[model samples]
Target: MVVGEFTQDVDVVVIGAGPGGYVAAIRAAQLGKKVVVVEKDEVGGVCLNRGCIPSKALISAAHHYEIMTHASNIGIQAEGISIDYGKVQEWKESVVKKLTDGVSSLFKGNKVERVKGEAIFVNEKEIRVVSGYEGSRYRFNHCIIATGSRPIELKPFPYGGRIISSTEALSLKEIPKTMMVIGGGYIGIELGQTYAKLGTKVTVIEGLDSILPGFEAEMSRLVTRNLKKLGVEVYTNAMAKEAKQTDHDITVTFTTRNNEEKQITADYVLVTVGRRPNTDEIGLDAINMKMTDKGLIEIDHQCKTSVPNVYAIGDIVPGPALAHKASYEGKVAAETIAGHPSAIDYKAIPAVVFSDPEIASVGLNETEAKEQGLKVITGKFPYAANGRSLSMNAGDAGFVKLVANQETGLLLGGQVVGPEASNLIAEIGLAIEMGATLEDIALTIHAHPTLGEMVMEAAEGALGQAIHQINRQIK
Candidate 1:
């Protein structure tokens, strides 16, 4: 039963309090706009509560566990190390709870009103929100929608007891002895690798020719090779047909690339194929908002929708549905709504994967630059050549690649597939955003005995100069 009725008039109303929504709300409030954020679930949204933060906590735990159990090579030995999944999950939940609570506190501190409910557009200027036992209406001069996306469920293998999504995988009580991961995207590979490190026999079947199809094959090769070391089997050009749930285990049927039928049995089947934007039933069309054929909201450079006073950001818009991307767009929308003349820019958006050695990329890679018919020069420096990597006993893996214009040496992009790739990509991303050159990076004095030195060395190589590695000419 609806328990309450209320009405609120505000300068701006932000929908879906995910990273994008909350950031937009806070920025709007800071700009002297009376802002209210409407969130159906928790304030932190899926990234903090379900996807990014929780998964990273679990991955960090698994990484530490691997380090503990496999430190014999470094003269550190442990007779046995076992996973306490209940405790691990408890710790993960605690981390998530802390971050979510912080988001709530920020909302209060920013003077942004919080309305707990599922909101739908009642008209171009108003929306109706229903919160469990309460209902309310809100009218706004401007509206911003930051509704995020969710994991897509397959038709044949619907999410349930034996079938699960990443959310369910993150909350598992015990580590499954065996698991089959369909769709070898970054999500599949990361989680599959995580469980494999924890002693789960992971089999990844991908419809593409290679796993992590979105990344460069050479970059993915490093991860796939490490997966082999972890005893995780991967099958490419494979199609998962259906799944059968039984009392003991789940049997998943698939067709191999050679057209041979095969079956893999696992405790559960984890599907990480892709995510669909959460753009349904929120009544966007009610506001005469323009949208793509696939339901993504249409917006201008400032994130303004066709309705002028309305805006959309994050997964509901075109681009990779990354949390940082959403957060960036949120700030743009908020600033634009506050009449700050802010605009969206995607030139330096970085993508990072927390796989075995980690992989990160920003700006244009060689393939993309070549496809665009831009003459480019590329250089690579390996972890083996970096003193820091060898000192850490990780010299056997990873490399840093720099892509730059052949004529101008303007830094085009960078690819890092090694330890701390996520952190290393930030410098190059900033360089690209600021339009720096290979000479700029090469001349900069990177700290000695650091992984970041590889970046500088790669820049030198791109300029046909050699210091740490032999310079190879690019035709």
Candidate 2:
């Protein structure tokens, strides 16, 4: 069957429906621009459907299950503690469905056209979208590429029934008796911890010398300790050689840093090494678009690609592969396309690890700060000393660390590893963005018995006025 070309004019077109693409489309529509969002899959992209939302849902369920099982020890009597994995999965799927539908309704409410198809660049000013099943073509003006990334598949361990990626891991039909996670990044740690709490014998293997390699060593240590307490076996400085499917188990062969080879058997293997940009199959080269050495779409400060009128954002472009980051970039690109001066300031973007206790940070770490030759003052307050953490029965370890300039007291960076660390790091990120100093943060009255007080305590400690802890006056 032959189909005729259909052309449609729009003020702005967004090519991915992930967090970035959808947000951009909605923002452009709010600005009174006729917008169309072309997505090959579901709206809300990976974050709402798979990556962030689903993973967090699983983590929350795991946390609840763990709490209920241990409720007796906390003086709450419970009987026949067990988990129905099937029901848990149903609940998780329901959450994802609700959010995805919400995103679709949002697009409808904002009058942003949602096209379900793969969009290819026919020219700088035109795009041809092939409907997945219908094989229809729709042309649009000024498109935004928000196509996200896919998990990087290791050559030795290809995805299959026994071997899986994060997407498959999230929708596991049944929890494995034993699982081997071949990565120590945030994703691996998060999923690994979730499974461990749910009664899976979980092991994490990392090629790096330490997990969370980008974070401070102290923070990583805290996470490691917490994970160990959760019964997760973490093997750092280890490389996976090969995986063999046995009659009853999957055997993973690895080499340790000390040149020792070992084997571990697990029912499931999750390969969460990292993600690669989804730049293939969209006919990028056909339009002569430039990409970075790392295969990310090359874009300027205004999110303009090498080709004019073709803007790209999200995982396809360079920067942290975070949903929020992509969303911001998407808006910037839309605004710039709308003739507004918008630039992305990458300095204040926050990164979070959703493992048990969680880890969130923004700006520079101590290592980066020291390498820049800036004298820094560091302060820390432990969760054990926090009143709220103790009351929640979640306070055993973890703390908040603030790094600032020694002379100017300007906040350089912040890290939090504890319950709701993901949420608590926001205040620190705001302070860094506002160039808040130690005194500025210390003077601000944080509510008592709250986790946020840790931020104030850390800042006060930096200024040598921490009232709750030992005070060492800065002279």
- Computed on alpha carbons, the lDDT of every model, listed in order, comes to 0.92, 0.88
What is the clash count for each candidate, in the order shown? 1, 1
Q: How much is 149 displaced in model 1, in angstroms?
A: 0.8
TM-score of 2: 0.97
How well is each residue in 229-312 modelled by candidate 1, as lDDT tens digits? 999999999999999999879999999999899999999999999999888979877877788987899888999888989999
Query: Deviation in angstroms for 327 in model 1?
Result: 0.4
Q: What is the TM-score of each candidate against the true structure?
A: 0.98, 0.97
Task: Report lDDT (Cα) of residue 122, candidate 2.
Answer: 73
Candidate 2 Cα RMSD after full superposition onto the native fold (Å): 1.5
lDDT (10s digit) by residue, model 2, range 1-475: 3255578877788889999999899988988889988888888888998899999999999999888988987799988988889999999999999999999899999999988888887777677777633544445557788899999999999999689999999998888899999999999999999999999999999999999878878788888997888888889999999999966779999988898999999998999999999898888888999998888999999999988878899999987899999989988988887789999898778999987678899998788899999999988898988898888886775999999999999999999988998899899989998989989999999898798999999998988888788977565
lDDT value, residue 234 of candidate 1: 95
